[model samples]
Target: MSDALEKAEQAAREAATDTAAVQIALAALELAKAAQQQPAPQHHQCDHQHKPRRSAGEWIGIACAVCVGGAGIAFASLALAILGGTAAIVVLVLRSMWTDVQKRR
Candidate 1:
C-alpha cells in the first residue's frame, strides 16, 4: 500500500511540473508573437514657415462660384447652374495661369 501511495505522489509532482512548463512556454510564444506584430513608430516633422497667400483673383473666383450656385437654386435648375459655375471656375483658373505665364516672361 505504501509503495502504491508513493508512486501516485510522484506522478502528481511530475504532472504539476509539466503543467508549469507548458504554461511558461505558451507565455513566451505569445510574447514573441506580440513583439513581432507591433508596428513601427512614425516620426513627424513640424513646419513653422509662413503659408503662401492666395491672390485676389482666386477669391473672386470663389465668390462668383457661390453666387452662381445661389442663382441656380433660385431659378429651380440647380444642375444647369452648377455646370455653369464649374465652367466659370475653369475659365478663372486658366486666366490665372495665363497671367502667371505673362509675369514670368
Candidate 2:
C-alpha cells in the first residue's frame, strides 16, 4: 500500500510540472505571435496640407485691427469738427464785442 501511494504522489507531481511547462511555452508563443502581428510605427510626415496653417485666432486679430483703424479715423474726424465749431463761435463773439465798443466811443 505504501508503494502504491508513493507512485501516485510522484505521478501527480510530474503531471503538475508538465502542465506548468506547457502553460509557460504557450504563453511565450502567444507573446511572440502578438509581437509579430503588430504593425510597424510610421515616421511623422509633414504634408502640404499641414504647411499652410492659418488659425482662427490670427484671422480674428487681423479683423480686429482693421475695425479699430476705421473707428480711430471716424473719431478723429468727429473731433476735428467739434474743434472747428468751437473756433467759429469764439471768432464770432470777439467780432461782436469789438464792434459794440467802437460804436459806443
Candidate 3:
C-alpha cells in the first residue's frame, strides 16, 4: 500500500508539472500572435518641410544678376564688364543644367 501511494504521488507531480509547462507555452504563443497582428511603427521625415527646388531659369536669372553686379563694381569699362558678366552667367546656367540632368539619371 505504501509503494502504490508513492507511485501515485509521483505521477501526480509529473502531471502537474506538464500541465504548467503547456499553459506557459500557450501563453507565449498567444503573445507571439498578438505581436504579429500589431502594425509596425511608421517613421516620418525630419522637421524641415519639403520644398520644391528652384527652377533652372530662376537660378540662371539670380546668378546673372549677382555676376553683373560684381563685374560692374570690379571693371572700369562698362562694355567689358557686361560681356564678362554675361559669360559668367552663361557658364553658371550651363553648370546648373548639367547638374540637374545628372541628378535625374
Candidate 4:
C-alpha cells in the first residue's frame, strides 16, 4: 500500500511540474507576441560599418571583379558575363538555403 501511494504521489508531482513549465512557456510566447506589436526603439547603433547593408567581403569581391574582369570583358560580352555571374550567385545562394533547411531537421 505504501509503495503504491509513493508512486502515485511522485507521478502527481511530476505532472504538476510539467504543467507549470508549459504555462511558463506559454506566457513567454504571449509576451514575445505583445512586444512585437510595439514599435522598435530609435536609439539604434549609428556606426558607419553597420549602416551599409553589404559585407566587406562582398564589396571587395565586387571591386576586384570590376577592376580585373571589367577590362577584359567588353560591352558586347558584358551581358553574357553578367548572366554567368548571376547564375553562379544563384547557385551559391540556393545551395546555402538548402543546407540551412537540412540543418533545421
Question: Which of the numbered candidates is closest to the native, going by highest lDDT?
Answer: 2
Span of 10 residues, lowest total lDDT, candidate 3: 72-81
Q: What is candidate 2's lDDT per residue for 7-101, written digit by digit as tens?
A: 99999999999999999999999999999999989898967575667799999999999999999999999999999999999999999999999
Arranged by TM-score with the best first, the candidates are 2, 3, 1, 4
Model 1, global lDDT? 0.94
Root-mean-square deviation per candidate: 19.5, 8.2, 21.4, 30.9
**Per-candidate count of clashing residue pairs (backbone under 3 Å):** 0, 0, 0, 0
Tens digits of per-residue lDDT for model 4, 1-105: 999999999999999999999999999999999999999888867666656599999999999999777676676498888899999999999999999999999
TM-score, predicted candidate 3 vs. hidden true structure: 0.44
**Residue 11 lDDT in candidate 4:** 100
Per-residue lDDT for 29 in model 4?
A: 100
Candidate 3: the clashing residue pairs are: none
The global C-alpha lDDT for each of the candidates, from Candidate 1 onward, is: 0.94, 0.97, 0.95, 0.92
Model 4: lowest-lDDT 10 consecutive positions: 43-52
* lDDT tens digits, residue span 26-56, model 1: 9999999999899878788677877889999
Q: Tell me each candidate's TM-score.
A: 0.40, 0.45, 0.44, 0.38
Candidate 3 residue-wise lDDT at 33: 100
Top candidate when judged by TM-score against the true structure: 2
Worst 10 residues of 2 by lDDT: 45-54
Indicate the TM-score of model 4. Answer: 0.38
